[model samples]
Target: MKQHTLPALLALSLLVGCSSSEEIVPDVPPSELYSEAQVSLQSGNWLTAIEQLEALDSRYPFGAYSEQVQLDLIYAYYKNDDLALGLATIERFTRLNPTHEKIDWVLYMRGLTHMAQDRNFMHDLLNMDRNDRDPEPVKAAFKDFKRLLERYPNSPYAEDAEMRMFALKNRLAEYDLATADFYLRREAWIAAINRCQELQKTYPDTEAARKSLAIQLEAYQQLGLQEAIERTTELMVLNPI
Candidate 1:
């Protein structure tokens, strides 16, 4: 009886192990997998698209549609709001296919991904300003867009990249100006002046730069530094409000 019981237990354990760790692998060819992925993409089923694309990639790593699979996965990840994985995929694609014909597209996608993830998700409902949020993500997006422009100046995405970079610049300048204003309100004259100076110098063409100069003038007056006040007034004259 003991011998029979031990063999049955071993058989049951094997059965359980087989069921528990079974992978959901498709038996169809890579071509069919890619087709299913495309169907999912067209239907806006990003999670399904990601799954099929990943299946195709694993089954046929060097298949004809391998590159497209990677690209589509990045887009799918973005659409699914899986931004971290999207970024990781982007990094892998860039590192692996640095000289790919569609590298510009990849770079543009990377910049777009950065922008998408940086969006202030609660800002609309909370009536919050985007510029009031942390600036690191915006700065990252700006840098990525800049890289795309420098490396692929004539690419189809260059215009959009430029537009995004312009918006990011304004936001960054606004953040710096806000910091200066915070200091000025607290009567931290030197800190406020430094913030204003850095904002203007770093983002000279932004609208906030002009505002920062105004803040600088106020900080100077508060400190009663006559020479600094005169110099700041001259700057304001040149900026014309």
Candidate 2:
């Protein structure tokens, strides 16, 4: 009986050791994958690096590999000129992991992405022919910056985002003022006045503030309201220089 008990106990201990070894092994080797991907990225083989990182994410699904892959893919996408993909990935990561260790970096990247897409409409319009009037991309960029400001007010990116937001707001307000000027040239006083009012209420710090108030004052004069003109001129003076 003693001999039989000793053999059974030895087999049980061996089985326990096997289980522990199995537990120690990860589904995917994160360090190896990360190193290979980093090498590929450094060699300017962005697509290859992306594929390896994606493979790790798909096969492992959940592990240290997945986390690092998500983090590193941002650079791969950017260097590959996949700006939309890079921005989207960073945005999703920031949203899902607001308290993650790298949240500051994610927020900064988000702001950078938005700022990168910005183009002055006046500049573009002057460069292009009359056929292109689509302001959607500029508006979308503005929205992206606004998202960073609203979502990550305390982030390191917040101050930069605020500055960009202010710049974009002024640009948008200028766009409106330009439209109002065009309307004024067409003798559409009501339309011009409405656009000026929008600038006064929505974007008081931009160049639009001076132009919009001046336009509004002219509109008030043409429409015959001395009091309105005086009030608008005073507003123009008080607006930021």
Best-performing candidate as measured by lDDT: 1
lDDT of each: 0.87, 0.72
The true-versus-predicted C-alpha distance at residue 225 of model 2, in Å, is: 4.2
Candidate 1 local lDDT, 1-241, one digit each (tens): 9989999999999999997664554668787888888999999988888888887878888889988899999999989988898999999999999999999988888888887776777886796876667888778889899999999999999999999899988888999988998998999989999998898889999889998888888888887899998998898888885
Each candidate structure's TM-score, on Cα atoms with residue i matched to residue i, is 0.86, 0.63
Compare the candidates by TM-score and give the number of the best one: 1
For model 1 the TM-score comes to: 0.86
Query: Residue by residue across 143-212, what tens digits does model 2's lDDT show?
Result: 7667767766777767877786677676677678778888788888899898888867787666766767
True-structure lDDT of candidate 1: 0.87
